[model samples]
Target: MKNMNIQVKGTIAPGYGVASGKGGDSRFPQGTIEMQKPFFQELGLDLSPYFSGTLNISIHPHRYRVKSFKYTFINVKWSSIQPAEDFSFADCRILFNDSSFEGLIYYPHPDTKPDHFQAADILEVIAPKIDGLKYGDELILECDRTQIDIVIVKKFWKY
Candidate 1:
């Protein structure tokens, strides 16, 4: 695949924190994990290699669109715990504070996601927990340009 690096700045924000939940007790993290299990397995990935929850980052001014040559949508089935949903992801490397981690930029289908998660400037990233990070802190996100398309909707805005 063609490779290029794209960088952007974002600030930490509070999220549903459902990925930190165990099993099907919680809605998002648990449900996402269960739903994505089959898809990952099909790709020869381990059943559960990601953190249970996600980190919310508000990317100011600019919004990103991902276009991958080899991309697929993940369909999450409805169960006793939650409703069915569809989402897409792009692999990325996140740089926060002084640490970096490999992660995925998760974009839930607009119609399928909760209202709170529909912000255009917000990004949901799944990665191992980063210590000493808290809400309102700024960080940098670098990803493969081939996998993501960025469009600056507004020139300046504060969060």
Candidate 2:
């Protein structure tokens, strides 16, 4: 078999704070504190992409250890990812079946510990048309892990 061991690089946290706040996280690299709307706009806002799909949140542990979690997209399909007119994009999602993680990215945290995104990271996503989506977008993904057993300890990127 090939190398099943991999390292996680970065992550997209869901609930981030800007100085003072309870919830709201930027899908971009941490320390890049931002508001969702403007952030999405920068990525060419189009909520339609999340109609029925997955948005992957990858983790690169900077080379550490940890488990992961994820949301599954059951009824999603490439064709259903609507608004296929001006710009076509892709959807990505990731999850680790047995782990929880936290750490700093981009800008180091006071704790500055390289955690999360371990060798056991999970990834699943649809291909973007082109340009590799160098920006961000608002997306919602649905997942269900009620009928499967995944004991993974490595990173996997599925394009």
Candidate 3:
């Protein structure tokens, strides 16, 4: 069956910088993705094509939940100092300035992740490095409705 797709308007927002290790976190100096790539590769998912850092997108007044997923890696023991974590991914497309780029919805299951909590309205995306993208820029994000569900939590002037 063909997957249903949902598109929503989002804004590029800044994250805690923990994913790319720019937050000065001593434990993950090389970034979380860099540390986890080999483990994911071992599990048969090659994340080498995507950027090392995540693109934080905010769909304010709208929260999200993963109803299904394209890929899920369970109990990934990427760090020696930290506990194993589960991760899920869903196919996504980011459109900005009339350009579209393929990406993945990077979901680190909160039940396993120890720290760096993200808001319900924020989505962490991984894609090829796009030039000229900056914080506060508006973009359209498309995701598989079956994999990721987005809904308006509050009607705040119809954002």
Candidate 4:
């Protein structure tokens, strides 16, 4: 069966500085994505067109689980000081103010990820540089249902 398209509203949120290396994260002085590019390129995935940093999008009340993936690189020893980690990507689109940009959902498996864990509501996106985009900006995120399953988490109130 063909994949279904799912659209959810999300807000851009600040992320851990390790992805861009702007923050003083000693583990990734050059940024995690920047250091991993060469390894990804060697694995036949060139991330040159996209920005080195990730866009942290928050979809509150909703969380996602990977049903499948478009690309998955296993045990990539990108950093000399850190152990190898696995990464996955899925086709995605970011829509804002009548403009839509193609991107990939960047998923670095937490099992192998050493530090900087993200909340379930945050979706890390890797796309070409987006101008005039800032934190707290509302955006529409589109993904394939077959590749990602978005679900709502109900809250319980204490009596």
Estimated TM-score per prediction? 0.75, 0.19, 0.93, 0.94
Count of backbone collisions in candidate 2: 20
Arrange candidates by lDDT, highest first: which order?
4, 3, 1, 2
Q: After superposition, which runs of candidate 3 have C-alpha atoms over 4 Å from their true positions?
A: 1-3, 155-159
Q: Which lDDT values do the candidates have, in the order given?
A: 0.69, 0.27, 0.91, 0.91
Candidate of highest lDDT? 4
Clashes of 3: 0
> Candidate 4 at residue 29, lDDT?
85
* TM-score ranking from best candidate downward: 4, 3, 1, 2
Top-TM-score candidate index: 4
Clashing pairs in 4: none
RMSD of each: 4.4, 16.7, 3.3, 1.9
Deviation from native of the Cα of residue 131 in model 4, angstroms: 0.3
- Comparison by TM-score, 1 against 3, better one: 3
Candidate 4, residue 24: CA error in Å?
A: 1.9
Instruction: For candidate 2, report its TM-score.
Output: 0.19
Write candidate 3's Cα lDDT for 2-113 as tens digits.
3578989999999989888898999988899889889989998899999998999999878888898899999999999999999999989999889989899999999999
In model 4, which runs have C-alpha deviations exceeding 4 angstroms?
A: 1-3, 157-159
Instruction: Give the per-residue lDDT of model 2 (tens digit) for 1-159.
Output: 112323333343332232112323333322222222233345544333222222233433322222322222222222222211121222222223333222111111213222222123323232222222322432222222221123335568999
